[model samples]
Target: MFGKTINEISLNDTAYFEKTLTQSDVFLYAGISGDNNPAHINEVYAKESIFKERVVHGLLTAGLISAVLGTQLPGPGTVYLSQDLKFLKPVRFNDTIKAEVIVVEIDYDKNRIRLNTICTNQNKEIVLTGTALVMPPRKRMDI
Candidate 1:
């Protein structure tokens, strides 16, 4: 009786978020998170590394997943409980990423949703995959 009402949730509910990765995005993330890894910030070092080019911070890309959860699907009132992520590919500057989430399971009693999350580049290559556990709002509010 305390979480999202059973009637308000359903399987297969989906949400999406998109952004074009930029140099500023990487730099700002580094400044804010204090993760100035060379592979993400140094052109010379990155060119020598396996990727052979600068790569975006993994967590910055993952933040798109958070945007989807916080702004869509279960939306504004949902409480993020946990997540499991697997990075499949590198994200580079200028790559347009589309992040998506689909509801796969609903716990009626607990008012929780288990969502399958994924992010793909403009080329449709999967770059990130994960599952998120969240608690939706207890009651609907009129907009």
Candidate 2:
């Protein structure tokens, strides 16, 4: 039973993953989020925009953080408490974005952790930066 007990996670632990946005991803997000802003889906409209191309939704990029926290770093069964994001650059279609999470703080008593998260594109430009709070499983205590 001791071996099965939930273990604590540390800040030094890290998880890195990458994903490339496709036209389908753009379309799906546009459809689901109801954010059919021309900048995201309309080619002609996007061409005239500052980016000169269709850009992925900021929320889509931020969503990668959820993947990192729920699957890799803290593994399954982790609960996301909150996330704060800043969009620094635009993420365009066909852009391969890399998401990284570095554990920053661990609250053992509360079973919570703070992570410094960032998403960067192929150009190595940081498109998003933020902090994520997650609740990982903890060893059960019995009186």
lDDT leader:
1
lDDT for each residue of candidate 2 in 15-87, tens digit (9 for 90 to 100): 8789998889989988999999999989999999999988999999898888787667776667789999999
User: What TM-score does each of the candidates earn?
Assistant: 0.93, 0.88
Backbone clashes in each candidate structure, one number apiece?
Answer: 1, 0
Task: Give the C-alpha miss distance for residue 5 in model 2, angstroms.
Answer: 8.1
State candidate 2's TM-score. 0.88
Q: What's the distance in Å from true for residue 56, model 1?
A: 0.6
Model 1 lDDT at residue 97: 97
